[model samples]
Target: MADARAANERRVRRLEQMKTNGSAGAASGTLKAFWHGGRKPAHIVVRSALLKRVEGGNILTRLVLPRGVALRFYLLALFEAQCRLAVGGQWENVLPLSGPGSWSDMIASDGAYDGKSGTYMRGTRGGRAAEDLRLRQVQGALRTLEEVGGERPDQALVEVPRGPRGQRLYPSFRLLQESGRGSHQSPDIYTVPTDHWHPSRTVTIPAAFFLNGWVQVLSPSEVATWLALRVLSKWAPEKHQESGVFLYGDARKQQFGLRRDAWEDGCQRLLNFGLIRFARPMKDGDPAVPPTPNSWLMDFDQPEPRERYEPHRYQVIDEGLDQDAVRVCHRELTLRQHALDRRAAEVQSRKNGGPQQDVWPQWDGGEREMRFEEV
Candidate 1:
């Protein structure tokens, strides 16, 4: 049976490869049309096989995709990680249905309660507070994951805060679970709003599509490079263009936290990434300029480039390069244009107001004919 399944899978893979080639050819045709006319073709061509299986989402549900994918990947990834870290079966699975459903039992067993379970629910003695607190944290993480993922998630595990009068609150996340697990025993991928499911349909997403969507994976090398970029970006070419020494000196002083060795390491990482290029290297036996205090070049003319070592600047990398960077750059350009326009208008106004201040009234209007007194 396994051999038969494997053969079928191989056959499917071969057919999919052919389909991809056809799609590429069609895409090339579309691009050619766009290049010629600057518009997409009125009719888009799709393989019959693809057309047969596309189940489009509803407008509201479709809108959810952006958040959905982000939350799903990040939260699920984090949850999986935490689960792996946690002692197996030591921490109970508390369904988020009730604020403290299973956790309440965990707390109630701790003898942290007084009257019946109902009494603790009504009164606050800080009883079972830990359970409630964990729930709160999970709730916060869930909300963050949802926004980041750009999708409404399975809310079956969620419950909102208590009402003003203390009634059970409605769930912010609505759960959508389907019956039965797949062959791998995974929970068959629950989603919010039930319309997204269909059997025998292949689904795929681009690798790195969530590049800046979730947690920024920071490596030591990457962190170092970011620090370097931050410091280098702030360099005032106008101020230090003449000496270049002041630039390195200031960087060394201001970036006290990152030592000389660390800075050099960071710079090495940045160089590897190709984000910057060296302007010039000091040659042996050449007279060197003394570095200026508190300048970007305080330690330049060194054997190697050094890291920028500025924390404030490294935040540029922490945020990650994404649509946000593009938007910010665009906004800055727009503002700069506005400022330029305003300055131009002011200059035009001055020009129109008669520039007689700089000229001596045109040599008193009539003293132009100097014919050497007819001599």
Candidate 2:
């Protein structure tokens, strides 16, 4: 523990020194480096086909996700873990897809919805009104499994080691391992590495965003669009935390095979959710030259203003119908982002030999020793 803390301190100091002296990785007055201790990255590994169906404007509504944040978190975690398990392994045959995650980290059920799966009420996590919300989330996940692996009912996704007594738990899926090489291939050729980088394409997102109940209410397409934007965010300004830093042009869209209508809907969903802010919708007149992708600014973690919000056309799942169901997503995101801001400030302050309010800001596992176990 001491060594780890010391290493973190050194890393902190090195980053501070770099930015202060305008050395490598220095940006305007801030550093664009990953903090020593910060947001817990939910490593996600997605296949190209899934995103195409979800984000690239698939017409089928069969695999549409349930608007529950908890289930979404489970899916993201499972997908990420499964990707890690795929590499260097038997990805060629009927692959058993699963990922290991603690209940607390994934669901945040706090033992409220432990044993009761079907008989559970709307008050599953929050209140009486939330009962249906939670149920639909479970349904969405089950349907997703059916969409992927329906031929064999026994092989369908299901939770293991059922929850204790009355406690409820989330549903899991078991899809027929995706298409790979021939069945005759030697077993030695396929083994998934536990590490993240082994997968050719993977992106790390803050766990809070997916787990936050606000994001859970979005349609699956909207979620994919948000994720697509995140992928596009890599091209944004690396040094600053501000949004509207990157552009998403026609070439990139063409390469990804993302249709304009799909792209518009995705961005519109994000805008309505207040996740991203567009200064202006795309301007008219232009088939020859691709317009600069500067109209939209990323607002995932940026602070939202208190003034009257712009006229938003998108509506929440239970908008105007339920009372407690409308947990202001923008407010939740703003708070999470605020916590992140404090973290960045602490890093800068500590480097300057000043005191830090909370030494560990986002999520802390610095004290936990590294261990490897079979999933």
Candidate 3:
């Protein structure tokens, strides 16, 4: 159905799956990422529909993730779990809530557990405690998805609202029955997007910083922005990781549906945490008005390290001709504005939770008539 769904996801997964499960000829197909440096880091399948929902502007209405990184991290664990289940072809293994069966009894993931019946719940988090903490946020997201899918919640949609420890619960993703052969089938199945498996759509995310405590406090948007950067990194890992790049193309903002302020704030956070630095692309051989990008590069590991990436160095040339140049000019202007906003955010963050600055001087000039400040 629609080749399993979602354009970007279909190709990447298909190629990788083909390489892993293909015939002798297909098995010989070598991917640079798979063979380069060392064996490629294993990936968790993230459904294209779901990724679009998280990052797409229109697909997901009534934004469910209101606060910070909880939603992002929850999705991380959920999708990882889905990837394993799909790969193993062990769909619908979660124990039903019938007599003599419980969540602890099912085989959840690739590993073995003592008290837990299955590897499913724990597999979602890859058996890491820090990653597992994010799973607590999954329940609310599930509720939101039910609304999006146009499904009304019936008693069968979920089980006990809370676990034994009073933690909000989510239905085990193991419920997706690909065969549809169970005595009682769930109307909703874990979605496996129709995969043409575009090889180019594959993204490689290194489990380094987050695993090592580098980005524990990121917000949801920050997480999304970081991921977008990670996707970009796939194009040139050495350049992206070494230089820490920017969203240089003017149209990429609209293409990715990123709100200006959110992206800038996310960049600032990454910079402050010593993970990245920003600067303008080196302008060299050019036609006078050399096209350059005001961008950020990773500041932490490199031949030369620096404390901050220089900003506000862009000087727009209004004399340029042609429509394309005009668009580039506008993007620079927008980036200039972003610099100012980021500085403002840094000052506000120091004050804790963006406190309003009392710039009215308490009694500016003839304030008896009216005050410009919030009352």
The lDDT leader among the candidates is: 2
lDDT score at residue 178, model 2, on the 0-100 scale? 21
Cα lDDT of candidate 2 equals 0.35
Model 3 lDDT per residue over 231-311, tens place: 445534554444434453332343344566656655654443333445355444311221122222222233443233222
Top-TM-score structure, candidate number: 3
Q: What is the lDDT of residue 183 in candidate 1?
A: 32
Per-candidate TM-scores read: 0.21, 0.37, 0.40
The list of candidate 3 runs beyond 4 A from truth reads: 1-64, 68-70, 79-137, 148-200, 213-216, 236-244, 248-250, 286-375
lDDT of 2 by residue, 146-167 (tens): 3332443322233222366944
**Best of the two (1, 3) by lDDT:** 3
Give candidate 2 regions above 4 Å deviation. 1-49, 52-62, 65-76, 79-140, 148-200, 235-262, 279-326, 330-375
CA shift of 14, model 3, Å: 41
Per-residue lDDT tens digits of candidate 1, residues 5-58?
Answer: 343333233233323323222322322332234222222111111111112311
